[model samples]
Target: MTLSRALAIAGFVVAGLALLAVEWAARRPDSRVPTLGAVVALVMRYDVGGLPVGRLAILLFWFWLGWHFLAR
Candidate 1:
């Protein structure tokens, strides 16, 4: 594999681990370390008047990206 492709795969693995850790933290009621997901929850407008389309699409993109890298 090329250097760039290898770097990308490594990055993806790190990101996936970080995201999973954040998600785990966010689920904990007594956790002190804040998660990126929590900050995004405050800032992002995932829904206007309560629709989930925008958030769902973004999630799909992330999933596709992870799959693409791992499939390489």
Candidate 2:
């Protein structure tokens, strides 16, 4: 696989894991995963008029990366 494809896949995998981590953290607030809890809190607190800026930016980044790699 090309480097771009590899990177895109890695990015997606990491993002998925982060979402799972956030969920886990949310379920058990006393959980020791401070970083994940912080991430969840940041996402929960920040927004662009009702929309989640962080998630939206992530999706857009992934779309742009996929397009850049696959369009050639």
Local accuracy of candidate 1 as per-residue lDDT tens digits, 1-72:
999989988998999998898779777898887776666565455677787766777788789978975877
The runs of at least 3 residues in candidate 2 whose Cα sits more than 4 Å from the true structure, single-residue gaps closed, are 29-72
Model 1: residues with Cα > 4 Å off, grouped in runs: 31-72
| CA displacement after TM-score superposition, residue 70 of candidate 2 (Å) | 15
- Against the reference, the lDDT scores of all candidates come to 0.78, 0.78
- For every model shown, what is its TM-score relative to the native structure? 0.48, 0.42
Best by TM-score: 1
Q: Could you tell me which residue pairs clash in candidate 1?
A: none
In the predicted model 2, the residue pairs found to clash are: none
User: Using alpha carbons, what is the TM-score of model 1?
Assistant: 0.48
- TM-score for candidate 2, residues paired by index: 0.42
Location of the lowest summed lDDT over 10 successive residues in candidate 2: 32-41
